[model samples]
Target: MATHLITGAGSGIGAAVARRLHDRGDELVLVARDAGRARELAERFPGAGTLVADLAEPDRVSWALGHQTVPDRIDSLLHVAGVVDLGRIGELTTKTWHHQLNVNLIAPAELTRLFLPQLRAAKGHVVFVNSGAGLTAHAEWGAYAASKHGLKALADSLRNEEHAAGVRVTSVYPGRTASPMQAKVHSQEGKEYDPARWIDPESVATAILTAIDLPRDAEINDLTVRPGR
Candidate 1:
């Protein structure tokens, strides 16, 4: 079974992906900021290991990944951790921008750099859970949009730099999903949250798994999922 490391594995899309992978009998290294949640998931999936770290803090993120006991060669690294802090440029602050950028972009870049050896050895795939915000800027989503755009750039650069080493990078751009983060977005918009208007996290997880399951010779550079209505 291939070993996969997943960040933000406690809830939302991350948790869904972990569940899907577990059901497929793949080994998992689940990382989340909440120790309790991570432990609960580990209990549910007896074969999975857990790592607790807040991706917003770079030093703490480094420490957690540094100390975690993972296999020497990981078959996949799924970057599912992220934050959605919405604000227009006029209302945005340095702290808010930095916090979002650190968690959404910098942390994943660091983790990818740290795991390069194992990824190279296994010729593994790197999946970035990006958003539609990464593609186009919205009126009040300046900070979030900026970070996601940078994340897209990061994935593009990694794909180009690592192709010769047999490392594949895929960016999954999921439109507004029925997630806690999306609920918060709807709250900010002063609108009732409608699950029917959003994509399901499990559906996105299935897309990710499909990308991972592709033949080694072929790679899906990008996959975008959007709500039907």
Candidate 2:
């Protein structure tokens, strides 16, 4: 069974990914901000380990990863942990922008940098859960769009750097998924967005797992999944 490490495994797309991977009998290392949720997930999968990490706090995140012992070789690294904030240029404060960028962009890149050696050893794949906003910006989504755009660029650059090293990278862009982040955005905007009409988190998880399961010689650099409206 392949071994994978997933960040933000506590809820939404991240939680769904963990559940599906566990069902497939893979060895899982789940990381999240909530210890209780992480523990609850670990209880469902035998041999699964949980690491409570606040990705925004790089020091704590680094200490958590550095102090832990995981499988020497990880077949896949899913950088799914992220936070979203909705605001126009002036409505968003520096703190909110920094917080969103910290979680959505910096954290994943830093984690990948810290774990690149192990991934190289295993010739593993790196999967990034980006957003459609990463490709095209939308109104009232300044910070989120900016952060996701930066994240996409990071993933693209990493894919190029790791191609020769036998490490594959895939960035997934899902448009309006049914996530807590989506709900928050809708609420903040007072928009009548239907969560049920959005892309399913489970389907996105399947896409991620499929990308990792692809033949080592094959590389899917980017994938975009949107609801069939």
Candidate 3:
């Protein structure tokens, strides 16, 4: 069984992906801000490990990594942790912008950097759980969009740099999904929350698994999933 490490695995898309991998008998390392939730997930899956961490803080990430007994080779590293704080340019605070970028971009980059040797050794895959905001900017999504755009660039660059090393990197752009984060976005927009109108987290997880299950001779560089209306 391959080992897969997933960030933000306590809830939403991250949790869905963890469940999918676990059901496939893959060993799991689940990282999340909620220690209780992460532990609960670990209990449900035999041989699963959990790391509680706030990805926004650099020191916390370092501590979390130090505490985990990472295998010498990892089959997949999935960056799924993110924050969505919406504000227009006029109302945006420096703290909010920095927080978004730190959690959404910097933390993932550092984690990937740390795991690169393991990934290369196993000829593994790296999946970035990006967003539709990364592809198209909206009025109140400037900060999030900027971070995701940076993520897109990071994924592209990593794919190029790691191709020779047998490491595959994919950027997944998923549309609005039913999650606590989307509920907050709906509240901010003054709109009714409609789960039917949103994409399902499981569907996105399936797309990720599809990328992971591809033949080592091939790779899926980018995947975009949108709700059918």
TM-score of each: 0.96, 0.94, 0.95
For candidate 2, write residues 1-229 as lDDT tens digits: 8889998777789889988988878889887676777778778667798777778876567778676665677889999988887878978899999898988998898888888998999999999999999999988888988999999999999988988989999999988888887888788888877878888899899888789889866888999998876
| Local accuracy of candidate 3 as per-residue lDDT tens digits, 1-229 | 8999898876789889988888878889877666777668778776888777678885567778787676677899999989999999899999999999999999999889988999999999999999999999989999999999999999999999999999999999999988888998999889999988898899999999999999878899999999976
For candidate 3, the TM-score is 0.95
lDDT of 1 by residue, 1-229 (tens): 8999998777789889999999989999987777787778789788898877778886577778677675687999999988887777998899999899999999899889888999999999999999999999989999999899999999999999999999999999999898888898999888999887899999999999999999987999999999978
Better of 2 and 3 by lDDT: 3
* Winning candidate number (TM-score): 1
Q: Residue 183 lDDT in model 3?
A: 93
User: CA RMSD for every model?
Assistant: 1.3, 1.5, 1.4
Q: Model 1: how far is 8 from its true place, Å?
A: 1.9
Better of 1 and 3 by lDDT: 1
Ranking by TM-score: 1, 3, 2
Q: Report residue 72 deviation for candidate 1 (angstroms).
A: 1.6
Q: What residue runs in model 3 are displaced by over 4 Å at the alpha carbon?
A: none
Supply every candidate's count of residue pairs whose N, Cα or C atoms clash at under 3 angstroms.
0, 0, 0
CA lDDT of every candidate = 0.90, 0.86, 0.89
Number of the top lDDT candidate:
1
